[model samples]
Target: MERDFDTTKDVVTNEVKAKKSAQAKADAQLWVVASGKGGVGKTFVTTSLGLTLSKLGHSVVIVDLDLSGANVHTSLGANPSHMNIRHYFEGAKSLQELVIPTTYPRLSYVQGFWDSWTPTDFSYNQIQNLIPELKKLRADYVLVDLGAGALEAHLNLFKTADEKILVTSPEPTSIEKTYRFIEAYMCHSLKENAAPDAFGNMITTLRDHRQRTLSKPFSFKSYLKEQTGISYTFFEALSQKPVRLVVNSCRSQANAELGHSIKSVCHKYYDLGIDFTASINYDNAVWQSVKSRTPALVAQPFTPLAGQFLNSCKHLIDPEELRAVV
Candidate 1:
């Protein structure tokens, strides 16, 4: 049976290669999927969305960028390829060479390193160099599953994406951490784009102040008002970056409504516009599929959870307005 499966995969892979060569260079839309905390279903969402996009006739590459704890390959019921991101980082392979064809024809993956092989520290220059190479891949869409937490590396990677998807559950702790992630990203953006010296001083001052006054929320708008020159207008214009939010493991209607509540709070406090795109119900099928090493959609295409994921993809593709389908 294993031999038969290999033969089928090889045939499909060859067919895809032929199709790829016959086509013109793909202008892919890059998406970065991230979360504030670990085990929030970020990888599950990424894989399901990539599969759904491919099923819609778009070629998609899901790159597992969660270097420290990479396991996106396991979710696809596949082992790590010999050529992965680690090889690319070590100069043994080009970014293009790292892409391995999956059993699904339109979906490919750039596998990630295992825990033992994960790098302790990846420099900013390395990440900056990776961005252009990723953009050069020929696919309709590229989904990068980022590591959880708001580390500088993670936030920088999130910023590089054309569109960013932040995943979180209804738990209070998860929501709090998600807000912190957003705060960190906003600070990172300001420091990079605005007056570096002034913003740096301001960030330091704010950090000290926050340590003293733990209950107060940091206000970007208020901070910008006090600043002079480019920093002021740059932050004002930062509102243009839209982040889509997905609420996962929702058990009830109230839990689902947390998406909207978070959006409202962000708009009021952070002056950041967040779109509450989709809420996924707490379904046992999701875990079952994961345990079986199959994507939920592929394992049970007609299930409600699968339908919800598809709807979320449609809304993501055409996000002129929010379509909350829980």
Candidate 2:
């Protein structure tokens, strides 16, 4: 495992600091992997996916952004004290200085394993600073495993990256939460720093009929259409954003259909983007990886589950031109 923080001053833009020599075109694409809720094999997928991608000859970095309960190390068999995000958080180094190589060849980890960092440790402004820094890491892929739900911090970080993957299982509750997650993101994104007023009467009507429990009521769609103030077309714009998903713990091709099912729900009701992604099968070794303190990709290389990890990467590989250094 080789971890190189020697970021060349080669790539410089208002977005980057002027560096010296041009480095190999960074296949380094930053990705935010999150689910509507926890226990969806987030850390497992994160660790395994990074290892698999690295094995494919792509340098991979996994940021254990499971902020409050960062279990990425436990799953990856990494030493908790072997220089992590805490080192950078404590003002001991720059982002480049904090990358920790993992057991997988060319794989590394940026851990936020410390729950004690608190809001005071790094201000909201600090997160804004860290975003670009992480983006500039010299690797083929940066997988950020966010804590569940759509909070201001989580959303900001996830949305800033090159791709946003909403991780969810196929269960009823998981599907509903996924919708709720989309609703929240789409609504917030639509406002564009403004407020969600429902454009007045239309919003009020929707709220009133939200749980009318009547035989026939104003549907959320009709509620939107009726609102002359709020353009339905504007809501459709969120569908154009760069977003996708990965259905975890899948069992078969039928299980793979969950992604499209959630896509249909979001497209029909919320009018959001849920295309361009992949899924992981229900592999028992995933549990073993968790229990045995190993990454499934590295632990069970020949399994069907390992193949899914590679598929997930293919689902997210970005364009070489967009990531080109300035």
lDDT of 2 by residue, 1-326 (tens): 12232333233342253232344544457888887888887777777777767776777788877766787778888767556676676688776777877756788887665645554233567678778778788886788988888776676776666777788887878877777777666555544433356544544553555456435634455556655455565445445555677888887788888888777766665444567477778888778876877766767788878767666666566434223211
Q: Candidates' lDDT values, in order?
A: 0.81, 0.69
lDDT of 1 by residue, 187-298 (tens): 8877765676777777775676557653565665776777664355544554555788999999999998999999998877666777888999888888898789888888
How displaced is residue 62 in candidate 1, in Å? 0.6
Candidate 2, superposed: residue stretches over 4 Å from native = 1-27, 115-123, 193-241, 252-254, 318-326
- Angstrom error at residue 48, model 2: 2.2
lDDT, residue 72, model 2? 76
Q: What is the lDDT of candidate 2?
A: 0.69
Q: Which stretches of candidate 1 lie over 4 Å from their true place?
A: 1-23, 115-119, 204-219, 229-239, 318-326
